[model samples]
Target chain A: MTTTTIHIPTLETERLILRAHTLADFDAIAGFYASDRSKFVGGPMSAELAWRNMSQEAGHWVLQGFGRWILEEKATGKTVGMVGLWYPAGFPERELGYDLYEGATGKGYATEAATAARAYAYDVLGWTTVISLIAKDNAASIAVATRMGAKADGTFPHERFGETIIMRHPSPEGLS
Target chain B: MSTLTVQQMLNSERLIMRAPQASDLQAYQAYCASPRSSFVGGPFDTAKAFEKFTAMAGHWIVRGFGRYVMLKDGIAIGHVGPLCMDESVAPEFTWTLWDGAYEGQGYATEAASTVWQHLTNDCQWKEMVIRIVPDNTKSCRIAERLGAILTDEAAPVWYPDSVTYRLYAGAA
Candidate 1:
């Protein structure tokens, strides 16, 4: 595996700014995961869990040449959430994933940021395929997957959640 | 609101879902030829099957939605889609694979159910649709298992050449 790091100072969308997660983002990131809202977004990620997740995301950039990005509000500079690519436990391939704070729901930020990441995966990283695994009951995520042009390949029994869907996207060269 | 990243869609599991490559074409072609490929018009010729596979992949870039080539042990077997079919009441559920060797295994159900959950719950799609050919007993069963309701309505004219079909409806 080639370990390449691309310093993305900031990735701008209509309403979001995708950047690297910094130590300064800890408190806000922790709060987002600690709230009850985290359950719906990502199911009760604790402060320690959030910190670990952030650190792991940062590690992905260094180790895999790509990783999840910290999402901030461009207008306010507030840390809203995090989204990006990383290997989920047990997955045979690299998967696409994301999360947002309670205050971030119902906005198009997920779609915008995810689309940018997909583009980066293909155009920058030269990936041919990307996958997104989502819980069965999480409708918000399904819509985002659809809007992003991902298709459901099937489902698998999850250790925590009963079952989850696996969605796929083709690279610029096209689908397999 | 924070922007969404591709990572949010993944959950920790034994297998990871990713895109298919050109090298997968031959294996995919063989999959389409398998007897269990019935759910997706099994027993297909390689040339035509490749055409269909490429078309589905194109939808990812053009429509922002398309099928994912399911992988296991580094081989392509089946596919699932957050598909949008106009013939029914709404865009609907879909899944298919080529290997009989992989059948009876819960892989299809696992992948489809995950995507469906994301679509209805996380994505907030209000209504979704799925249309199965009347003869495709396996697909019909799978759709029913997903809680898709069968409809009496006849399929539209634009549908690919197929016999009678049962429409299944679900929350968007």
Candidate 2:
């Protein structure tokens, strides 16, 4: 319910484990922003900026109690990337966020992780609604949202990414 | 110091090298709002500046090390210290002085020198490098003054032509 340094809730799906982000995940997070692939997120940045972003994800857990999570592949116990609830300052509303490393895509991992996260947000966090802000060019993410029962609901003029499609979770309670 | 955290301080003459604070948003926002901020991806409005400012303070929690808020006479003029991003091969020692009024006072060299020692001697880092856009001669001079020798590379996607200077831990 509230911030707890003692424990963090971890979620598991068929092939993935969604857990709180740790410094161990910093390199994956930072390297993502450092590469060209980070273009969809906010990337190709300097190390300090990448560190700043990695710190934000970790800080979000402490401050928001529930923030983006590290997506670990159960098959290898490797952190592929991050996904979960992201409601940072300046957000128009609470959002369902996700991102994956280069090698992790095209395997339905994003859909699987996002579905678990959406449920955690609705059932555990008790949020009435959750939205995923997909950049116009982020076709893969849009497809994942679609497969997870999200639909194009509106558009948000995001400060960084400009126009973004807001996809609403089909069921506010999350898929049972 | 080897045991340094974001909240720790490295005090020296004419400056206090401590971690960033929540209250730094104002001075940071003002600095980023000015045209002089172009070198650092600034000229941001209040909202953008707010995001950038908070991120500076928030970075400490995840990384365990970040820039300290540089203070003179108990006022925040800017930040300085060991900076390393996710993609960096090694950390960089820098004094990112903001506010045009605070320039040319030799604080960059002083703070950077102090930070370099702390990072090398106290922290025991093997080596560190500074990445600067080629046109920023003032910062380049500071790096040179700190005994950093120029070697190209380490530019981000935006600043493709940036100049990199490496400072070995053994340098005086």
Candidate 3:
């Protein structure tokens, strides 16, 4: 019985390193889910549920061939957020998502990380276009999407979070 | 950190236990929707079920090992293995039959026995634990047959109502 291992690709930006998640990231993940900032992303959940959520993100890569990555600051080697491609069940289409930890947002980390993720989706995975599902009230995220040249295409109603705005990014050709 | 890796597939006389895959999500979602899933926190909506399925696969990446789908004749019937969610705790050896059609066939015990050896012999795990709800007689019976001793330790804080059992590496 030979053993098998999985490899999650790492993406690099100018200042951030998007890499596979480790168990070591659980504490930082739990902290994000516990804070009010996580509200738009289906969070403010218990630490136990948070563990499951992180694992879900990691598994997404295996099941889908591409998933989210932990955003690490190259200078400090600190985990600042997560950004990547996502398309879970019930979702209308594939998405490019991003989330920044407390004290990490003002620096455009989400935009920077998300640009790399979107490029991977379009250039590497050959995806034509992608969308981001942002809570209706999340202006900061909306701003990030705007900066990425995404426009409000439609809405997706979530069971727990109410109506969400689906912002569509530029097509692969449009980006070039 | 030690790199923990488990065999992708384990073959028993009557079952093939393998790691969960992308193709297994549909069956898992169906299982979660059925009444059979009531015991293990199921009957989830499609969204939640998808989350659970991905999480199951991610557990392997996060902890270097996770549950395996019990494939009977190439169909995924259920999953069995040790799942360690938190680093501070022992991994729980869990087993489930996704559909009622697969129940009462003694498949759980067979697959479980094979998994036990893989974890103990191949993976070198010294201790294993299981948590079962008091009313889940079938799961309780499986625990007993595996030589897992009923322990005074409470279940994980998240599942307080359940009872805990422990099986040492050499005891089973």
- Candidate 2 regions off by >4 Å? A1-15, A20-66, A87-91, A100-112, A115-129, A136-152, A157-163, A169-176, B1-8, B13-23, B45-64, B71-75, B85-90, B104-110, B131-166, B170-172
Q: After superposition, how far is residue A157 of candidate 3 from its true place, in Å?
A: 1.2
Tell me each candidate's i-RMS in Å: 17.4, 4.8, 1.8
Taken over the whole model, the C-alpha lDDT of each candidate is 0.63, 0.76, 0.88
The residue ranges of model 3 lying beyond 4 angstroms of the native Cα positions read A1-5, B1-4, B155-157
Predicted structure with the largest lDDT when compared to the true one = 3
**Candidate 1 chain B superposition, TM-score:** 0.74
Better model by TM-score: candidate 1 vs candidate 2: 2
Q: Which stretches of candidate 1 lie over 4 Å from their true place?
A: A1-9, A40-42, A173-176, B1-172
lDDT of 2 at B117: 78
Cα displacement (Å) at residue A113, model 3:
1.1
lDDT of 2 by residue, A108-168 (tens): 8988888888888877888878889988888888999888888999898887776899998
lDDT of 3 by residue, B1-172 (tens): 1245577789999899887888788999999998878777768988888898899999988877889999898899999998887667777889998888988989999999899988788778878889999899999999999889998886766677799999888875
Error of 2 at B157 (Å): 8.1
* DockQ winner: 3
Question: For model 3, how big is the CA root-mean-square deviation?
Answer: 2.0
Task: Report the TM-score measured on chain A for model 3.
Answer: 0.96
Per-residue C-alpha lDDT of model 3 across residues A40-131, encoded as one tens digit per residue: 98889999989999999999987888899999999998888999999998888999999999889899899999999999998899999899
